[model samples]
Target: MQLPLFPLNLYLLPGGISKLRIFEPRYVRLVKLAMASDDGFGLCMEVNDNICHFGTRVIITDFDQMPDGFLGITIRAMDKFVINHQWQEEDGLRFAQTSVLPNWTPTEIKYIDRDLSQGLQMLFDEYPEHAAYYPQPDFEDMAWVCQRWLEILPLGTEQKQWFMSRNDHRAALSFLHSIIDEELKDK
Candidate 1:
């Protein structure tokens, strides 16, 4: 499927709602297309300021046009996909042929131990302001949590891109644990 890409420095989790303030002309156009069509678009992470190969297909659940020529939109994640090919348009918008991937499996969840679970709970507890924003850490929730944490962590953009590109839920969770452990130790 060919979809319009919206590359950002943030991570979006499944079963999560991301409220975006779209001010750029191209993104505004993308929002309009989504509204007029199926209300779905791609939320992709950037690699060195470029869109990575993998991303999630999201639906615009709610949107309002701001008086300041921007759009406030809420997106719900629906599926994960890998960009098979990309084409750049004259207006700076990208069109990509994407291959949707299967859902994360149960075996991946087994890799998450009690220590990591408690650590995640503690991290959320420590950051009260970010608590509500944090999704429930579970097997079904790992993909989004991994993506979300990758975005919020003080890691390099390259690392964030790598995390987003990862498809194995277990590998992603393990990487997240290492990152969280390093963060906890530094504190």
Candidate 2:
């Protein structure tokens, strides 16, 4: 399916929330269209001045027009998709033909180990405000939690991209555990 592209430097994981300030004229139009459409728009990553092949289909949840002529909006991540082809129109808006990937059964990870869970728990405990948003450590929700952390954490763009490309929850959970351990150690 052909869809409009909104490329950003940030990563947007599934089930995550992204707030965007839409000041650019093209993006303003994009937001309007997304609000009117059912499928919404694609949020792609820009790597080395090129749009990444994978992106998430996002749904606009909140929108308000600011006095500065920018739109303050929040969007929820819905699904992962791949850009099949891309082209630019004369008006400077990017258009892409995309294909949604079939949802994969997230590999189950054992987060029940008291030691592992405690380590993860401590990490979440450090940020009490974010604790509510943290999912219970389990096989089904672990990947989603890791992906959300990867998106919101102060990680490099390359690392974020790697996490997005990964579909296996077990692998993602393991990677996240290692990264979190390393970060905690450094601090």
The TM-scores, one per candidate, come to: 0.74, 0.80
The local lDDT score (0 to 100) that residue 139 gets in candidate 1 is 29
Pairs that collide in candidate 1 are none
Candidate 2 residue spans exceeding 4 A from truth: 103-140, 183-187
User: lDDT tens digits, residues 76-184, model 2?
Assistant: 8887888889998776789899888644354444544233445556766787665554344442455555665567678776766666666655666676668767877
Error of 2 at 88 (Å): 0.9
C-alpha RMSD in Å of predicted model 1 compared with the true structure:
3.5
The whole-model lDDT of each prediction reads 0.70, 0.72
Clashes of each: 0, 0
* Count of clashing pairs, candidate 1: 0
Number of backbone clashes in candidate 2: 0
Report the number of the highest-lDDT candidate: 2
